[model samples]
Target: MVVGSDGFWRLLYPIHHAETIRQAAEKNNLDPLLIASIIRVESKFRAENVSKVGAVGLMQLMPETADWIAKESDIPYRGTVDLSDPETNIHMGSWYITSLIKQFKGNRAAAIAAYNAGPGRVSRWINEGVWDGTFETSEKIPVGETRHYIQRVFFSYEKYQQLYPNF
Candidate 1:
């Protein structure tokens, strides 16, 4: 879905439980605003939104990743369509993001990139030590799309904080 500059909902998106998203993020020690912002950037909060690449739902989870998360988290195996549910999506996604953060030693940019680009890309960045302000280590961020994804999410993080000051 195409989101405008303002980031308002032009069409109804299925973010039914802001509190659930918040709780999952907090439980994982992630900034709730950051999670919310990523959802905004990733899928424009459109649950059931599928990417051309087959990432599904509000967080646009890939099928393999969704299966992995479900198995790892002991969440019941639902078909990919259940990803549209804010509560389930955020629960699994928040856990997965927390996993990435640990793997990257709390590097927000690296974890975020991994979330977008995949673990292999983030690992290369870690090894090469090439990075930008948007990245702490940039050696292996070869994919331009992942780079831009990181930038957009970081920008959205700030805006999310402003939109909901308490979050």
Candidate 2:
């Protein structure tokens, strides 16, 4: 009841796009908290942010990936420029996460790793016996960025769950 400014900001940051995140998660059959965690890690809820590698919006979707998802899902894509729009970006990103989850057979950690490292690479690592695609073994993920990414997302997810149980 007595949350300070810092705590309030922390709570607000992850839930800034609550409506869009909830809608996207529901449509994609994903946990809204997971989406919020990803948004927190990817863009800190900044809809206009763009990564150095051209990832755009709150979900940080790359242009080519967005186009491919649009083609695969038959969703009308207005091009990467629209990725700056929170609703469009959240929907597309949520769809992508669902697709990745399916590809990895519901292995959330592997799917999340793929989201950062690419499915092909994750599959290769699994096939080659490099990493077992489990959270416990994520430390062995060869890609440092992806390994840290998975940890960060999971950490944020835990925080979200704690801070907003209803999320």
Candidate 3:
């Protein structure tokens, strides 16, 4: 298949909150492209986006999850955190993904899957031999949404790399 021009792809996969993404990723020792990919797949860079399940902001993080992340990551929180803020959401999301990567032993597929399906479920799948937590075996993951979510993040990540090589 012939891919679209870089300009066209850039138009479709625009990166918003670059500085915030960079800061969050760097602080968490993560690739900014990965964060951008997650944001694209999660909320398409829309800060006000909210999922049907109460996930909010560009990263579509749930309030409870954000609160947990803040506590774990030592981010400032006093019960009411505005997840709609790009900086806060990206930082928390980055930290959470970084933790997930560590929890899954750097298995990005599993980490990304856990980001969508929750760590407990992913761990259960791994422990039960339901899935091996590798990108190659992502198809074996029981949750279709998580499998598709990983695929989308990967696609967006590649496009971001291609369009913004220097980023």
Q: Which ten residues in a row have the lowest lDDT in candidate 3?
A: 73-82
Q: What order do you get sorting by TM-score, best first?
A: 3, 2, 1
For residues 14-90, what per-residue lDDT tens digits would candidate 2 score against the true structure?
58878888898898999999999999999988899999998999989999999999988855589988899888899
Q: Considering TM-score, which of the candidate structures 1 and 2 is the better prediction for this target?
A: 2
TM-score of 1: 0.82
Q: For model 2, which pairs clash?
A: none
lDDT of 3 by residue, 10-49 (tens): 8899999999899988899999999999999999899999
Against the true structure, whose TM-score is highest? Answer: 3
Worst 10 residues of 1 by lDDT: 5-14
User: Cα RMSD (Å) between model 3 and the true structure?
Assistant: 2.2
lDDT of 2: 0.91
Who is ahead in lDDT, 1 or 2? 2
* Better candidate number, 1 or 3, judged by TM-score: 3
Model with the higher lDDT, candidate 1 or 3: 3
Q: TM-scores of the models, in the given order?
A: 0.82, 0.93, 0.94
Residue 11 in model 1: lDDT: 38
